[model samples]
Target chain A: MEKATEELIKETAKDIFFKQGNLHATTQDIADAAGVNRSLLNYYFRSRDLLFEQVYNEAVQSKRSQLDEALDADLPFREKVERFIDVYLRDMRKYPFKEAFLISEINHKDFVLKNKKKSAKLISFLDEIAAEMKKGTIRTMDPMHFLVNLFSMLSYPIIMSPLYQQLFNLSHTRYENFIDERKDIILQSIFI
Target chain B: MEKATEELIKETAKDIFFKQGNLHATTQDIADAAGVNRSLLNYYFRSRDLLFEQVYNEAVQSKRSQLDEALDADLPFREKVERFIDVYLRDMRKYPFKEAFLISEINHKDFVLKNKKKSAKLISFLDEIAAEMKKGTIRTMDPMHFLVNLFSMLSYPIIMSPLYQQLFNLSHTRYENFIDERKDIILQSIFI
Candidate 1:
């Protein structure tokens, strides 16, 4: 029952946040949305800020870990890049508001910073890619720059979905199709 | 004097919203920070949400129009991409919090459904790009995918600077250097 309530809170809060944003969303709002007592909101998470952080951390960390694992796997760089794109798009679809929420929170004073470390293995994997660039196995470029652009091209769309959906009149199906085609586009943009 | 006061209000509101997420910020707080009467805020802008939309529209439209004009200029695709990166980085440096704030606003329900028609020109540009892609002059890729990744890599660092600064232990000088090199990196990532 504890696990169930926790799950309920997560679902309710996520829905409320994406709909209303963090500022307008009250604890009572979350409690009412979750069909639980307002006190239970505090019981599960001490404050709205804390609750926001919990969701933010969970939403962000899950993607980070998966992408890290994909990058760290003993695969060719090209294969790894493809896997990274897949993992990123899949994750983006799952957590549509995570990018915007986290970006907004980055500048929040009430947002007490959390120690969400990047996986060491991912960093080392990135270093290896840099080494390959230096050795001319991959194109000559800064790995940091490459990584930033690569992920940005893939991830920015989802974060900007509300904007893009407006601009392109993209249906949900078409938007997913757009995401599906990014791996080739990104690779050709880089490895060529 | 009216212009100066309006500018002050905008500047103050930007700082507060940047420092605290929109939920925690109030019009009263913004008015106080600007050293103006609370009534002045509404007098000038009608409401907090409308005032924020003005700020966001200015922020996005400013960079966007400049970039759009550049894209229309008779430059090679590679040079245009480089110019886009340079211009984007420069604007991002000038208005560090603008994109995050705009993105946050875009996610809110009040704006999302209401403002769909206001974004047609931005979508048209992407459509034009996709049309170009079909002619095989540029590499084949979904325009939306290309767009998402490119913007994410280029823009995410700025929007999420506090996180990156902490995690990377990036000094101001180092961050500037990273941005300086980003134009070439972006060109390389996009150009075959």
Candidate 2:
């Protein structure tokens, strides 16, 4: 019951913070939404900032985990890159605010600077991929460039949805199909 | 003289908004930074939001102009794609906040949705390229996918700078070199 309640608080806080942003959201709002007293939120998470950090970190790690698994699988590097894109895109859909939350945080000077765990796990995974690419298991390209491009192609639609809708006259109603249609286009763009 | 001051104010306001965000920045902050009085800011732009809108619109227009130029050039579709990447990257460096500002505004859902001049220009250009691609002047891939990937490869670095740094353990000191090196790798990613 304790774990369940804690999980409930976290899910509610995550939704509120994502929709309202960090500064705009209040602890009481999270507590009320979670169906818990304000003190329980602090008791479980310590503070709102700490709670948000947990959520953001988990979201980033979740996506990283998916990517790491794909990279670690017994597949050729070319196939890995293809599969990585698929996995990354699928993971991104699960966390719609992930891009926006990340973008807002990244503007700060030390936003992700202190998170050694995330940094290490991701870099090690990248290094392994880079090593394979170096051996020509993948086509010749800078691993970093491939990494950046792969993510951008995968994440750009969600991050830049406003620009797309604005420029293309696409309505909010069309967003689902628009994004679905663009997936193949985005993939082809990178691997064509 | 008036045009230059208007330009200066817009530049200053954009820098402030892009770096500090909407909540922390004040109109006086923009005015003082631009070496003008608050009244002058109001006289010229009416309000902070208006000033921001002007800069945002101009930033979009400038990027679109470069894209249209490269895409509409008489070069073949493949060459156009390469040139588009080069020109877009070069121009983006001049306005680092373009992506961030746009993303934030998009998140807020505060901006008016209207047809961008660039949209018409770009759609026509892409349609023409699609025609050529259909004729086998370029390899077979959906045009929209080609576009999504091309932009992702080119723009993802700026858009996701924080995530990139954290995930890869990259230092800000090496950012320029990192992006410069990626150009070739990104180009190859598309071709292969």
Candidate 3:
């Protein structure tokens, strides 16, 4: 019962924090939204600040784990990348404000988004990239550059979707479609 | 003298808004930073909100003008693109927080960033992109997709520099070097 209540509070907090843009949302707000008491929220998170930090960390960690899965999957290199893009696009649609929140956090705050475990995963992903380069499935270049290029293509449009819409006079529907069309566009650009 | 003071206030407000993330910085703050009195700021801009909107619009307009110059340059398509990348990289380094500030404004606020003149500029850019495709100087594809891909590559790395640093374990110096080297990587990927 306690674990379930704690999970509920955290999930509700994530929704309210990321979706609602309530960075300063109070514990009372979380409790009210979670249908629990304030004390229960405090018992789970100690403080609002701690809750926010945990939520941010969990978000990054979850994304890292998903990348780990996609990169570690026993698929061909291009297929693996395509799967990763699929996951990335789906997540971007799910959490439309995520990149904005991340940009603000990274730019304006002293919050250290540290993850010792995820560093290893990043190295592994890079290693997979290097292996793909060796196989000539991807162009022979610095593996790091390839990784950066792939990520830039997958994320740039989605992160700047609104600006793209504004710049191109694209409605929301067209903007979303533009991003949806990027999978093949990105893949075609990357693969030989 | 009055125009200079107005420019000073505008520049100071931009510094506080983008660099310091003080979206709600007061007229007094701008005046103090500009070394002018609050009445002078109000006299020039009429109100704080008006000042902010002008600052935002002017930033967008300046960038659009820069792009117009680059796209209109009488160079070959590839060289023209390289020149634009150089301009973009220089501007991004000059104003690291611009994208973050833009993202926050676009995502969280009701502000509409409108510029009727710039819509014509975008059309010209697309026309240029289409011409390049027809000449086989660039890949044969939808001009809109090419523009999106080009802008995505140019802006994404700069916009997400801090996050890229965290995720890739890049120190500030190394991360900068990575971005510096991307002009070729991006251009080569785009052009035949």
TM-score of chain B of 3: 0.80
Q: Where does candidate 3 stray beyond 4 Å?
A: A1-48, A113-118, B1-6, B19-48, B113-118
Interface RMSD of each: 3.7, 3.8, 3.5
lDDT per residue for candidate 1 within B38-76, as digits (tens), equals: 999988898877897777777667755865765665665
Go through the candidates in order and give the C-alpha RMSD of each one to the true structure.
3.6, 4.3, 3.8
- Pairs of colliding residues, candidate 3: none
DockQ result, candidate 2? 0.38
Q: What lDDT is reached at residue A62 by model 2?
A: 73
Q: For chain B alone, what TM-score does every candidate structure achieve against the true structure?
A: 0.74, 0.81, 0.80
How far residue A165's Cα lies from its native spot in candidate 3, in Å, is 0.9
- Error of model 3, residue B90, in angstroms: 1.1
Per-residue lDDT of B140-168 in model 2, one digit per residue for the tens?
A: 66565566667766777775666667666
Each candidate's TM vs. the true structure? 0.83, 0.78, 0.83
Judging by TM-score, tell me the better candidate of 1 and 2: 1
**Candidate 1 has which clashing residue pairs, if any?**
A23-B23, A148-B153, A152-B149, A152-B152, A152-B153, A153-B148, A153-B149, A153-B150, A154-B149
DockQ preference between candidates 1 and 3, better one: 1
